[model samples]
Target chain A: MADISAHTPTSEIRSAYLEMTHRKRLYSGLMLAVFVALMVSGFVLADDRNAGGFWSGLHRLFDFPAEVLSEASEKLTDLPAHFVHFLPSLIETVNIAAASTLFGAMIAIVLSLLSTRGLARWPRLIPVFRRIMDITRAMPEIVVALVLIFVLGGGPVPAMIAIAFHTAGALGKLFSEVNENASLKPVEGLQSVGAGWIQRMVLGIMPQVAPNYLSYALLRFEINIRASAILGFVGAGGIGYDLKNAMSWGKGQYDEAAAIFLLLFGTIVIVDQISSALRDRLTHGARLEATL
Target chain B: MTTVTTDVITDLKGRADTLFLRKRLLGFALPAAVLVYLAYIFFAFDIPGLADRANLDNGKTLIRDSYSYKTHVTLDNRSGDITYAIEGERKGTYPDGMRPDWVSDRDGMTVVDLGRGNSVQFAQGFARIVQQDGLTVTARPDRDGVNADLPAGPLPDMISASKNRLMVTLPDARVTVTRNRVEVFKYAFGWELFFFTLDSPYHGMGFPTLLSKAVSGEAGAIWDDFWGNAMWRHADVAWALFETILMAFLGTFGAAMVALPLAFLAARNFTPLMPLRFAARRLFDFFRGVDALIWTIVLARAFGPGPLTGALAILITDTGSFGKMFSEALENVDGKQIEGIQSTGAKPVQRYRFGVIPQVTPVFLSQVLYFLESNTRSATIIGAITGGGIGLLLTQAIITQKDWEEVSYYIVLIILMVMVMDWLSGLLRRKLIKG
Candidate 1:
């Protein structure tokens, strides 16, 4: 905290200021150097462990995509048929996302209510329920899916349950955040009427927070679509499974692979666009309602 | 004028009524649609056939294996040799002369105490089982398959009888007899060999005893035994856990570093050229649309398989997301702040450094931190595909079809890892952003 310029003449202030700035610059430079070293060493270590070298693999990066694209163009006439062939699988993937989101949202509502302060049925057990949500949310979808596939056999059900489990945990946290901003007046009014817990939640909290919940759910749905596709690649059943098969076939099946890639990409973009649009409207409408 | 006023009031009333009517209709229609969709899914997913295909026994095995380990007491009929093992694995085999308290070797006869007065006596010629209910079951190997003599009444459901084998299922224990061997499995709670395998000297020592030994300068020995546990593979699991976190760290930070500069190019305020900005935005879209799953696949081809490939996949996919988010943040940067800095005759670079970065750092940093937490979960899935990290180990264990205990262990560790990262990121965000 000492200032060397304070005890010196007025002329020394500029020199002291410059000295301080130089020291600050030196500290920042050192920090930057350390960061650079970490990144470089980490990259090297990763490259060493990797099966393929980084530099050699860089040029070949576009090879697979190019092959698939060229082959699809060559068989352009079969593109429509391939699209038809994969449509059902695409539907299945979407269904998985939709059902999981529906089920997960249902569970998340209760969990959020339980975990949120001032809204908890049993305040003492709020931490328990919150931790439960945390653990469930922390579990990656593939862990449960793979484990369920072992017991349930390979099917969409495993994927559905796994995704729903994770979705519940994730949506639960977001729902609770929304719940925190909700007015307690409605809840108190319902309580004065001697309504039951479920009744109070449905008639009081549900109406107040419906818009935010809907928006968050829409976002989750968009995410779940991508997750479902990825799960399919791991053999949970969907277009992802077919894509994997076609991919493994290497050269001959590039057309089918391209079709799948297109389907997945198109579905994702469309869903994202639709959901974002819906979310925008929902929030805008809510703001309008507030103004009115 | 009076008629006009009346007409307007009536029109407003009609509109309100119609709105409520539509709302009511939608309430019913939405539920109806959801029900119809669910019905479609039920058949589409073949839920009806799921019941037939579901292996309830596998569920039972998984649930049981997660909590309880069965110690196998085997009597080799051919060699007249007796051995005891946990989960029937050699890694859990007892030492040369050491055995569990429940099992006693009396001369040539092996007697397994199945608890609560249920004991199985294995001998050279025959095996005898004492049931908790006082039913004495005896099986003798003969030419006409093993002959079993039971109480003269009808056989109970707990006992399975066949020409080749006789089996008795107990709540705490089980006894099975075949032509070749008689085996008894006693069920116990908790994971066995979690700290020290059977070969270790510290296998059955209580926690208090271990602590005392540690205080007596045996700490290294204890640590070595626990760390090198063959059945659990603590060392490998730890390494896999580190690799998973490393993947997330390298990916999230690396993407942030790459995206920050690129974001300036995409930001409309920073880049006046329409075509260049459009191209940059399109590139972001391409990467985002391709997504982490496809990116992982493509990268794994060039990178082969490791944490590096998974990290790069995350880096590429997240670069797109960060670029889009960061460009928007940059575009929204306060023009007044930059103008103020410029009024001091500061260069463009210095103006951005002083005015723009400080404004956007908190928002961008928060976004990056959030991604850091999420990418940890993503890394697990990516690692499974790329053949690295705990995810790979989990799949391998699950595929082997029996190591449900190890699967459960890995799952617990993964959940713990995510929770820790979640806590750590939250802490870092509060500290760095607020400070």
Candidate 2:
């Protein structure tokens, strides 16, 4: 209204806005169409390659679950015994996660510190460390685990190494992000006191970032637990190995599979709950209520 | 009053000392605990035993095979017919009367140039290795054994002679003679038959020649040969990569679409019914708690192994995650915009459309894009289980034990794929979120 003049009409502005709106709608429609086309074609291609049709398989989805449930119900008394038998394997899985997280987090702390701009010991080598992290992160755990399993034979060691390898890369990126937000005054103060690089970092940055690092490492632990289990299924040896054995036996052995599933499910839920609670404490302190 | 202040200062000092003491103790205790746990794991995981169980030779073979390939030149002692094959594979065998440029055949005599002034000559029943440093090793195969002649004070570590076999291992070539066959293996760097196999007309064509042929309208044929290369199977690998990406794309977007509406139910701000909200939340938890590994197994049972199973597994698992995150996002949306829209006589749906969505769009899109990149990796792992994508190919290549070259190729491709996806997602996230 302030810019309006005697020669310029309101109709011209309205028409211009309308044309822009029309063009936006057209582009949106085209984008939506392309998205739909891609989804539909992808679905069709996947369906074609699948052993069973999606439509046909949809109804039978519950059948396997029902069978497993029924068998477990029938063999309900054996559940406690099965749990006892598989408990050590469960502990092994948890240990794999915990150890890998510890190792990975330690490596990540060094890597993140080295890669961060202001805190870097050698500014020139930042890109090199960053590239190392990127390459490590880009590698899937299964790839390394399988290759290691070939050389080292199947065991928890391979799985542990695989998960730790990936966790370092992942946690390194997150920790560097955390490092960026930290004030450099403490580091400078420590440096002015003639403290060495390690001492400066240990005395300065760690206190500021310890909580966030713990929170992220805890989260990675949860993820690594799942990863270690999956690696076990591929012959790396854990509870998942037992589960695979139980599953491969088929039908009559469904009770064992059920027990393994319950143990895994329960462990995951418990770990998830505990870690989230711990993370909440670390991040929010006393401000956030006990939601769990 | 001074005494009271001094007492307070002493109390504060006491607390500070206690806090510092606790921190010092924790600093030591945490690493100590970690070390103890690691030591326990070392024993429990049998790390010491690993040395005994581990096969170092396999590692050597894997490392060696990844970068270099060997061409087998075998002579049948009885018939005196020589055969040249790359990696000793039928698919890489030279055609009858055709061999490498380094191998020459004239007057029933064949000499293979092993490079670095080393050569292997086969004439009649005997094979001789000629070294530039004035060392000649010859072996003649007979029914019982190989008769070996060596200019040796003591046989070097590179040469191992037995009753029925005489073997010489050098940096460039290896000659092994048994009772019935004499074989020379010439090692060369790089993946052999990567582009075109022995059957293809363009197998050994130079880049300039290939370019000229392409300019002369032979591009499609050349591409077809490369694509359909039996040794490498480039087309299958490309398709597998596409399938892996497709699984990620379809799973991520599919989960987002399915979760958005469900998220409204789960969100405390959107749904007034507590029971319904609880139900939705529990449903999401159950979906997520089952884990993608279990979901993949369950879906594979129903759908059978393919990209569909992998995609559905990712979809179901991610739906849970997206639902929780989306609902949390929905709960945190600013109510002022919705109130403004409501004051304009807008219905609930219209209010959500104009007011709520714009605020949440950036967060939701960023989350979805992040998941898209991660799901690409998950798709790879799930593909291994379900037998669909690059993971399946990688696992297959690995399991073959001897196809380390192919395994390395697939690994490089996978890493590149993941990095590209990561870059693409980051680019899209920045572009879409900001613009």
Candidate 3:
């Protein structure tokens, strides 16, 4: 009806467009300035607080790696032996990750089902379940692990429980998101057949979401491996505890540290590669099915 | 023809039956595998031994200390000096001539009212405790070991007396006496001297009176006392929390900045040189494969223990992740937009700025924001290892063993900080990506 831009004067339109562009540029420039200022100041403040200044530490950055490498190379023959010695600890670390992931994924499945819209057993309490997930997810693993370590007196069990608690919440949110995309037709069919809540979920929804859940759980396994190792550093029984022990012995025991590092790096890369390949297959299969 | 068709039908049925059998076997096998693994882990992690190692008493103490505090009324028997302190910490000691209302000095005798009809009396050389049930226990320390006198019926489990020391642990209070001194710990609820220490003029002022004083120009002094509170260290805690957030902010953005350029080289479409792309990709992998835990250790050696080290550790680890994600995003970018820009005779940089950046900015920013939220948690963990931020404070408190209240406070703060960051990031993502 009213073609305002067409009816407006060309000179006025040009000025208006220029003015808007100017304002946009001004805002963006201001934002950039603020961001830059924050970065500069934060860096300076951190450097000030740090034991070693940034400029001083910059060149020495490679020193630590070099020291470890030289020490490792000096005892090259012992490297394999060191690896063997640490293998059990490595296995224990991996086991911690695997067990935690399993327990966490199990808890996540229940939590996700209870919180997901339409799939929720008690729809009125959806928010309650969601809050529980959020709160659990918000807690850092170290916090819980340390507290448990205090009570349990430092063991793999404490680390296992801590990681599992975090994994449940983190995976629960993702699983619920996956659930929202699932079709309710199968669930309705199961309900019509007088299936119980658990039976309905098991027979109807799980088959559709199993691949995605597995993919996510595999990713979580990789992350939990890292978490378990770190928890070990804080005195949970694993390779990290060994690494810390080796590190605290100062220069002489670096070969052990080096071996542990190699083992950790190798395990992480292998696990990452395998899990990523599996995830690709899982997601790719789903996509192929969708196209069909 | 009928016979041939019957054969075909039978073959199909046989195949279906075999498939069902295999599926049924698989269903059982998977759960069986999980069960076996769990059984293995139970032994591997030594779950059975954990029961013996677990200190349920430490758990009880941690829980109890988190909610309640204890005030100690100690009498130096030799010098006849009575000093009162909360939590037995020197910082919490009452100033000279001042003590808790429950404790009073009368005629050279100090009486500690431990509430609920339980009271402890500390005189020149003896300490006496009267229980709520009217059972009185007296202990004297003179020349030799402690001499304890209790009701003859049977010594209650709460009272443990030995040759040189006597301790009576009641439900609401505790009394310990030795040759050197007599100490009575009266249990109380809430964190004592949280805002102002006993030495401060405004230590016990009511909220209304404090507010009026603040309104009347004592605000700065009041704030100073609260902020510099020795027991709570609100100022240091605030700085630590800020440092944590700063570590996250600097790390996430820094990684994004570092990764953006490298991602171009890593992207197959952007860099035609196979070797360069391979190198870039491997570099990213190397960065990522070296876990943050290891990076924190290495960087801590270079930068020493501080937030900077933690930040650098996060930055380095996330750079790898961001590089991989960014390069992937770059590879998937719609070429039509860049081609259109190119057709206008724009330079490569301009093409990227006007065409590619706009398309990928939403995804990039959203990913960065998500990492920022997650990195806040990482910062805390890193801080613990590297000695900075609330993480360091938290670990210290936990290690101290007696500062359970402080540990709880730090835990609450950390949870709030992470939740806030999560909410903030989500809000920003919605605003930027959708709007």
Candidate 4:
């Protein structure tokens, strides 16, 4: 109150502050307006280019599902037989997922160790390995599966290879993140004991990170199961291939489609439950270790 | 202490050794199991049969065509008129009175120089391939059949001779002479006519010349030519890429907007009604369990094939994911802030706005952004199945079984697009959440 000569008027400060807030509000409003416009136009463009108009398609949305449901309900008695028939295909799908996860995890263990800062065999080439993982991770599995289907002639093997290739890249990054938290003391102790590189990694690092690695690998198995099915739709072999064939067969094969659906859905839910339980246990155990 | 029993210590040592032995056995057994399973898969997947089914020729074509292109030199034996085209595409055909540098006409005889002394001379009714290694072959298409003269000393594998046709394969080019026409494929590096089609004046211009032309105010024309390239369909491909991104964008954000409110309905603190919360949660699980593949199939029947259908498929799938994640995030929000807002005499909606939203918005946005990054990939796969985007082009090119170069192009573009999205989403996440 006494330093009037040095102080600015309160009203002037208030107005300036009000002006700033107004401007801020106006800018936010403008951004929202632009976003809304973009969304609207994008929708319209997509609708216009679509073979069936949105409004027309909206009415018929449930037609195929309704047909499948009705036919499946009528042939409910055959569902059991159909399920038995598709069981082998479902097994193949699960096998693709399990095998790919196993192979991919093995590759990821090596890649993760190579890429991790302290655990790397060739520390100088960490960035190189990281970039390789990035490129591989960016490559969509379908591209590989489609190409491999051309070469390998449409089998589960292509799907397995593709999913495994992707899983290695994806799991490698996560595994390296886990590796970053591992203690380096064991590694040093092994080095002092004249342990070779592989021995050091196997005895020193793997035990520390194996739980997290297994958890991630199990999570990957869940994802790979879905991926294997999708690849089969694109012409790789599995339940998805069987599903596509059944779907194309139409009306008469609705029971088969229903059976495959039941198998796939059941398998997905069951695997998800098992893997999540294992993951919970792994993390819980890790937390216990940390607390101790 | 137990009286310092010596037998007890030995028992402990024996147990430790047994445990270690068990672990060692397990280490070997596990690897052996994996090996045995792999052998079973090798037999089950029929690895041996694949050798016959697998088209090694397609592999060769894919590898070769990805990096190099071939120009075709065809002489219609009937008209004696030769036309040259890149990749044998009509859109790449040389216009009248125009030809590549490697090809020339002198006194009604067309000479295709295949470099390194390997050359082909096409005349009135005969063709001569002069190989770089001095092996020569002459083919004259006649009334009965093609008259072929092979070089002495057992015809090499490079040359295939028959009554109706004679084929000579060179390092740089391949020549096939039949009764109807004489064709030679000359190899070159890089994609030809990638920017401008054969009809464009800018097609064969050198960089320096192009710069001068652009400086002379021909930039718009040059761009138009490039963008409108018939051989590449640059405009359509660009549009497809845009559509792919648009699908992912609309799907991810739309799902977020739809899920946020519904997530509150499912959250334990927000929704006290047990039945309603259970219904909302189960709906989310149902949507997720259906997966994007089945959803795409179902939606494709309704909407037909387009980016719209792909968008809807992604939207439905992601809504379930967002609902579950967002509800969990909502449940985790600190109750103290909301209680403070309530104590301030604020209404439920106002309390949510002032207290709850701010705490969870970052979590919500991070999850959405993560999904946006991943949904871009899903959109590509969905596009492949439903017939839209670069995936469609990739599948089409691959299915053609000959246009492996285009498949390579589409693959590179898809990867680049995905990486760009990945970088962009990461940048935005940092800016929005942390900043």
Worst-scoring 10-residue span by lDDT in model 3 chain B: B102-111
Please give the RMSD of candidate 3 to the true structure.
1.6
How well is each residue in B69-113 modelled by candidate 4, as lDDT tens digits?
999989888888888899998888999999999888777778899
Q: What is the lDDT of candidate 1?
A: 0.91
Candidate 3 displacement at residue B403 in angstroms: 0.4
Per-residue CA lDDT of candidate 1, range A1-292, in tens? Answer: 2575467776687788899999989997998899889888888988887888899899999988888889999999999999999999999999999999999999999999999999999999999999989999999999999989888988789999999999999999999999999999999999998998888888889888999999999999988988998899888999888889989999878999999999999898889889989999999999999999
lDDT of each: 0.91, 0.92, 0.93, 0.88
Residue-wise C-alpha lDDT for candidate 3, range A190-231, written one tens digit per residue: 999899999999999998999899999999999999999999
Best by TM-score: 3
- Give Cα distance to truth, residue A25, candidate 4, Å: 5.0
Task: State the lDDT of candidate 1 residue by residue for B1-435, as single tens digits.
Answer: 999999999999999999999988987898899899889889999999999879989999999999989999888777777888999998899988888898786767678899888898879658999887789989986556668887788889989989989999998888988888888889999998899998988988999999999999999999999998989999999999988998998999999999999899999999999999999998888878886888988888776899899999989989999999999999999999999999999998999899899999999999999999999999999999888889899989998988999999999999999999999999989987998
DockQ of each: 0.76, 0.81, 0.84, 0.69
Candidate 1 clash pair list: none
For model 3, name the residue pairs that clash: none
Q: Against the true structure, candidate 4 has what lDDT?
A: 0.88
DockQ, candidate 1, comes to 0.76
Second chain TM-score for model 2:
0.96
Error of 4 at B62 (Å): 0.7
CA RMSD, predictions in order: 2.4, 2.4, 1.6, 2.6
Better of 2 and 4 by lDDT: 2
In candidate 2 chain A, where is summed lDDT lowest over 10 consecutive residues? A283-292
Ordering by DockQ: 3, 2, 1, 4
User: Chain A structural similarity (TM-score) per candidate?
Assistant: 0.93, 0.95, 0.97, 0.92
